[model samples]
Target: MSLAARAVLVHRTTEYEELLARHGTHGQAAFFLAARGRSVEEVRERHERTSRALAEVTAAVPLKWRRAQVERADLDRFLFGPEDVVVVVGQDGLVANAAKYLTGQPVVGFDVDPGRNTGVLVRHRPADAHRLLPSVTGVRTAVDDLTMAEAVTDDGQRLLALNEVYVGAPGHQTARYTLQAPSGPAERQASSGVLVGTGTGATGWLRSLWHHHSSPLPLPAPTTPHLAWSVREAWPSPDSGTGHVAGLLAADETLRLVVESDRLVAFGDGMESDALELTWGQSVRVGVAEGALRLVG
Candidate 1:
């Protein structure tokens, strides 16, 4: 790491703020919560805990290095330096949200509710950030480079995913597409969607899908370099086939999908808000990303 390197903190909007944004007013937000037998105080408490965690993280970064902070929703607008050390202060999922925008910058994930969190990605606690921040920049420190998944459209729009990428109809309606693996013949299919998950994501959505399989398959480790692709709820029909429902994408291979429907969408790490849209006759290639997350625990 360079002496001029800085710390970039990735923050997420609290649940209360989201409710306020959705309702347009505090009173309306509170009423909606009350109807669900919840209270504003509960949301406020959660926000307060996150606030204190952020304060700890903010104070822990060295004053010699410049600091930058951005909310998860505004990640695309932020400019990350090559020497920046990214700090994610939220749940584990927030770390995944930040990973897509980063290009090999060392990431330190701190769990806001450490005691309650059983997450694998966000391993550090709020109180330990002070010690962890310096370690990430230490000369002798080594970080793990975790594999990431990606989706590239025929027209060249690309998206990186730290966990998994969902490719399918916007509303998850039956997806009509032709799936082609590196060495297999293309097969038309109708399904809810296709999920391409990295090794780190196997413990997440991929795990649930794995549980449904009659014969269990080996789930990848966090640092596995390949991607696992699966079709969700495939339905075999006159025009659709299911022979190519699951496969592994080696680092050098591409899993291609030719769209046969009116429209299909692709999004990474469950963030549907930022997605790529594909129309009929379009194609999307799924593969391992060249830029992986350099994570420090």
Candidate 2:
């Protein structure tokens, strides 16, 4: 028998929820925020908005469809099926948080608090769910296939990120590795870390890095099947070279790195908890992921 379509609502825990968990009561949470010159009321209001939006989206799911909900914290443990339609109701980051776990699933993003969020990814609202759901599930709506970055370790571990991937030491210490660009001779280097990002990530950390240093390569457009990579704070020494610091990667190309340090980590979309660890001499390849984010309007 064919599997039934499922609507998976994904969201992150609001600040109000975290405050309550930390302080144990509304009054205590309020007091904690007050001491920091912030208002708990504002946090509570945002939480309520997200909660209401989630409820509306959940109710909008077709009666014949199966439904499931996964918080951002539990995404690593959640299982996403091929017949699932993901509905993300939160800020743009929440959408990125769920993207790595999905494989060509049609994603509907809702910006619950448009005034506060930039809403680049979560462009729709709760009320639009009623109209959008049918088109999405029917595969009749226009979907933007946003490019993503992928990192694969030699041992067969793989990670995908909608925004970008960071490969380096777990903490502040500098990471040592051999750098090899798509079309260049490999060179040994010691530096902070390496970052590889997709066009969907151009406006984020990649932009910040670009601002400090100029590059000949152009940043990819949101749906472009390309990647941009850079080495952060590459240290120059007689034993290390900085010639291969930054470059652009074509869809068919990849940037390679062989870890020279005791240990290194590869993480996507800023979720450090769900990361792949690499030891010395292990090689990692960063490139464009084959699957794109099927973002539904």
Candidate 3:
């Protein structure tokens, strides 16, 4: 017996009409989730428009509407059977936020910005273990419309680190914060915010705020004594070398910063973090998280 193929179609706006037109079939239900908050009337209208276009190809196509923050357990129920595909649609920020709920499944990402036109998808089948996923045809044409790609995870971690989570003191403007890494303790600049980045976020705003170059240039305490004393470069390098500089700060997708006195604010990847407070002389751990996300072309 042949498999009754099931595909989950996810997109943000009406622009994906062309891609949906290509892969969506009659029996498969297209799930529409919007990143932005829209009124019931507006959402219903959008669904109706897409439904009409889908019906032209095949009748009996079910269209469902739900709040964008679809839970992981619910998705497990929705994709109970095998051969089901999950597609996530949004700009880079929205896509990164949605990834948290996806956990360990193959995720197809669709973004509209050409600069953000990238996707991470994973294939886990043993037979096709090493083969690459086929690149989305006409991707350039849809560069402004939709850029679809996939992300894979071996240990069920999201691959895209678009920002850093920061934790800092409350109320006090420009508080001195203690940064605790595995090795030792260091005093970071006196500021309302302090940020840490993943390897991927080295090129973001953290570099600019510190006046450090993106490439492998070693960071020294700036000649200005005030900035140098507060924002010191603990890591030492023999000379400038590509990809050999210390980890970045201020602009990481997964930033965790500690504020002075006793307040902790942690947020990353454009998502909100829980408020935490730690007393003085207390230790806060900081480091990299090891995991792999699947990448789809």
Candidate 4:
């Protein structure tokens, strides 16, 4: 018999909240959306759905366990404990955002609205939490150890990516860097950017890049131990030789990049809000992260 655990509900800001923030008032936001055939009431209903889903998950938790709620914006500052079991009541992107920050705690992805949400990470509904809690709390349970990517700068700064890592100049401009992989000659290259993608992210930006060419590379599973790297729009010039533009990275392998530009940025999972700045002569090592996201199905 196992004891109870802390259940942290992870949620994102509502559309209405965002609209109000952008338009400066709910009335103004409603008028803006009304012009596009949307009503403020519709946004309010979606917000209520998320709130109701949170309540449902809360009720599912056993009384002996500790319960808390957290917004996605506050996730970076939140301290997660070893025994914590996270229940995310939002879309898959919320889960992706949280994955980069988690140590190894099991995350229960419960979709707030199944009809409208294509939540690949949120496999279960809020009502399913009643039966799923045991899987996280019980001794014998199935947990998917989802692989994650990491970027380590030469200066010792590190960033984790749940989906893919974009290393390039700000504003998606041209990037100049040296590409180095295991058992290969270092090549200088000029390109828009380099994207390091995991199996889970293959269906996202990587998929588009994969289709950019006639020959498509095989994508790995979400829990696969490997990753893929692709350089977007590699330009060959006298100063830049492009040989190693795309390749697969083994579980133990890493892709090392030496920045040649005046400034470079590394961000993960399509979130421009979080990133690392790389300067001239600096290098960053991109590879599999030491930790994984324990996803509860």
What lDDT tens digits, residue by residue, belong to model 1 across residues 1-297? 346878998999999889988999989988999999999988978989999999999999987888989998898778888899999899889889989988878899889987677757788888997787877878666678899999999999999999999999988898999999888788999999999898899888977776655425576677878988888998988988878777787889989999999999999998998899999999999999988898885
**TM-score for all predictions?**
0.93, 0.97, 0.44, 0.93
User: RMSD, model 3, all Cα superposed?
Assistant: 13.9
What 10-residue stretch in candidate 3 is worst by lDDT?
A: 221-230
Give a tens-digit lDDT track for model 2, residues 29-106: 999999999999999999998899999988989888999999999999999999999999999999999999999999
RMSD of each: 2.0, 1.1, 13.9, 2.1
Give residue 250's error in model 1 in angstroms: 1.7
- The number of the candidate with the highest TM-score is 2
| Residue-pair clashes, model 2 | 0
lDDT of each: 0.88, 0.91, 0.34, 0.87
- By TM-score, how accurate is candidate 3? 0.44
Cα distance off (Å), candidate 3, residue 203: 4.6
Stretches of candidate 4 exceeding 4 Å from the true structure: 1-4
Higher-ranked by lDDT: 2 or 4: 2
Lowest summed lDDT across 10 adjacent residues in model 1 is found at: 210-219
